[model samples]
Target: MAHIASLSQLQTPPWASVDGQLVPYDGVRIHISAEALTRALSVFEGVKGYWDPASETFSLRTPREHYERLLRSAKLFHIPVDFDYPEFLRRLEQLAAELLVRERDLWFRPTLYVTEGHWGEGTRATLVITAFTQQKESGEPMRLGVSTWRRGTDVDLPTRVKSSANYVVARLARIEARRLGYDDAILLNREGRVAEATGACVVALLDDEVVVPPSSEGALDSLTVRILERICHRDGLRLVRRPIDRTELLAAQEVAIAGTISELTLVSEIDGFTFPVDGVLARLRASYLQVMRGTEHLEGVEMVATDAGRALVTS
Candidate 1:
């Protein structure tokens, strides 16, 4: 979408929840000198709300887990969450109620921006919930390539925290991937171990075991990966996390990228190595599709479905 300088702001919903207060989207503002703008001091979470045709409701994937992770990011960056957790959730409930009236898919991102505080004065932050209508991907097969850009280590902008700054790596990696004639890039660590795909977690099926790189390898603490692990255990598949060398990914039986936005896209060809469409990723996608269609529900994650108004369908 082309972001027109002034008019682009008008395209989103009329209202936004800023620091627990629902305000006009046009009225939402942050100074040019703000820490989020100047120092890139902001952390956020991506939550997808899928519109289910059968139930005539919106199904969200792990909004609670996303929020909890956001809070942890805030804590790590010294950005105090200025809003109450329950109230924060209620704000989402309140926002979803009003916004989902159109009954289409949407993406809600709750970003915690460090509005103030440097030195010993104590940092403060603002929670802004922005909702926009987005089309859900049908999980396509992707051509993956390894990028020369290594994902940053824990000491240098850790990958574990879902921070705004992390997008630079993803953004650059994506551009480089496309430029290199591929759909996306797999970022390797300094040690040449597989970290993750550009913006999603990496899952490889090696010798019938679903293998994932550990967080120590600079992979994000992915909720989608957690769901995949549960699915593997439920289906009698072994899932393990360890450092994956660059060559190991080429040898994986099936490889895919997992995330909220990316969904679960299988990697068809990586570095010229082709993985014929197989049941490994297909099985995972089946469960994910079930979750989307609400045949299978998330445990502890509220699937917010709007009837005439807002209502919570908890797991």
Candidate 2:
């Protein structure tokens, strides 16, 4: 399966929600002098709405969890969340309904950012919700390489907060890896311990147990990683959190990357070492997709509305 090489390949929807109001995607704009654009003073959440063909419904998996993380990020950055969780959820559902996304999975990006005024000190925060349909992943395993750049430590920056500014470091590493002929880059913390891939949490299979780097080790407290932990526990699989050394990752039986957008991507190679795609990882991915599609019962996932629920006009 060919990967989505760039954002240019994605077709943006005609409509988007700005501050809970539906507006034309082309018309939605932020000030050029906004702090979010100038200084990257923003935090956002990437959520997926899985379309269920059997039920003809679209279910947003663990939206509350994502919203909670977004709120935590806002608090960390001192960005004001003027609207509550319920209102945000309602607006997301409304945006999906307005888009009339009938049998395709959709992606939702809800961002909170600071605006112009006072040169980035105590400025008011703004919100925007953008929803669009995207092609599913090709299921091709990614080729990763160890990055020369180090992940930001807690002392340097809040590793747990999903700040837009934090991604610049990962972006540089990814660009370097692409230049060296790799799909993605794996970052190690200052202590030289395995941190994570760009915007994704990593788990390795070792000695028949699934092990992941702890949040203290510069790994983002990823919601998808937590979901995988729960699924592993329920299935009688051993899942543990421990500091993984760079050498340990190279010798692992298999490695998998989990995140909202990546969605349990299998790693075929890291640096020069390669590992086969394991069955446990495949099972976990299948289970996750089932839960996301509402075919399997899972907590924290809900179907807000369906295509048949109401009539909508996209234009």
Candidate 3:
């Protein structure tokens, strides 16, 4: 996923847990020719943790889903890591407690990076858990734009996996959008259908339902979008999964970007086409925040606190 901390004044801790070792951030290093750097032999998951002052805890949103997706990405790219799911969670809890202070939201980037070798040979993956605090406002809904470049298909780059190399395409598109004075870019698939916006999913409201482009159309399986899907089903909101045309989005009543970092940023316009700030997106955003930020109790969230006496002691 694209960095959600991009819009925030993020604070990084002094230390990072590198392959189960707590190493200082400045001490962390990899060779310039490492496979991860040269060939992008890595996959990562961005886990957001909401800090609840009343409870004195950091509630992690859908960690299991994100973990499964991370494993799938590693499997797809053959990025072998030494740690299993149990060990992974242990490291995350240990790291977050060490890095994050009380009363602050946390973000973790658990990345499996190959530090040596090349072209599917002589490679070993290391788990690097990078932590940050969402210390600033994310600002207003992004002023979005559409890139002229077409996104790669599953047959080539495989959007089903959140591989590091896949983002090179997004980086290019993002540069183009920034130059044109737009905050972010939405890339179309090879067939001119809406795939996703950079690292976020493209969600549009039409009539009574919200439309999301399927993974078959080059959209990555998004964790945030999946949560929103369940919210819609539970709340009786109609959410459709299909290919979305650019014009279809333009003509829709509302548009927004959904992902781990962007959360539910409502779109102001796209390629000069304006979208209204409607109730549908607002409701979805509100429900999502209520669930994610611990205001509303929901199933499948992992809460961790610095001290056992602080709050809901899920860890």
- What's the ranking of the predictions by TM-score, best on top? 2, 3, 1
Reference-based lDDT, residue 155, model 3 = 81
TM-score, per-candidate, Cα-based = 0.89, 0.92, 0.91
Report, for all candidates in order, the number of backbone clashes. Answer: 0, 0, 0
Clashing pairs in 2: none
Give residue 259's error in model 1 in angstroms.
Answer: 0.7
For 1-315, candidate 3 gives per-residue lDDT tens digits of 134335224454788889988998778887888888888788998888777767666666677787899989988898776777778877777777676666567778888888876788877888888887774244367778889978898889999889888899998888899899888899999899999988799999998698899999889998888888888888899988999888888888899999887788888889898877657898898888888777776555554444422433444
Strongest candidate by lDDT = 2
Residue 3 CA error for candidate 3 (Å)?
8.9
Model 3 ranges off by over 4 Å:
1-12, 136-139, 300-315
True-structure RMSD, every candidate? 4.2, 2.4, 3.1
Clashing pairs in 3: none
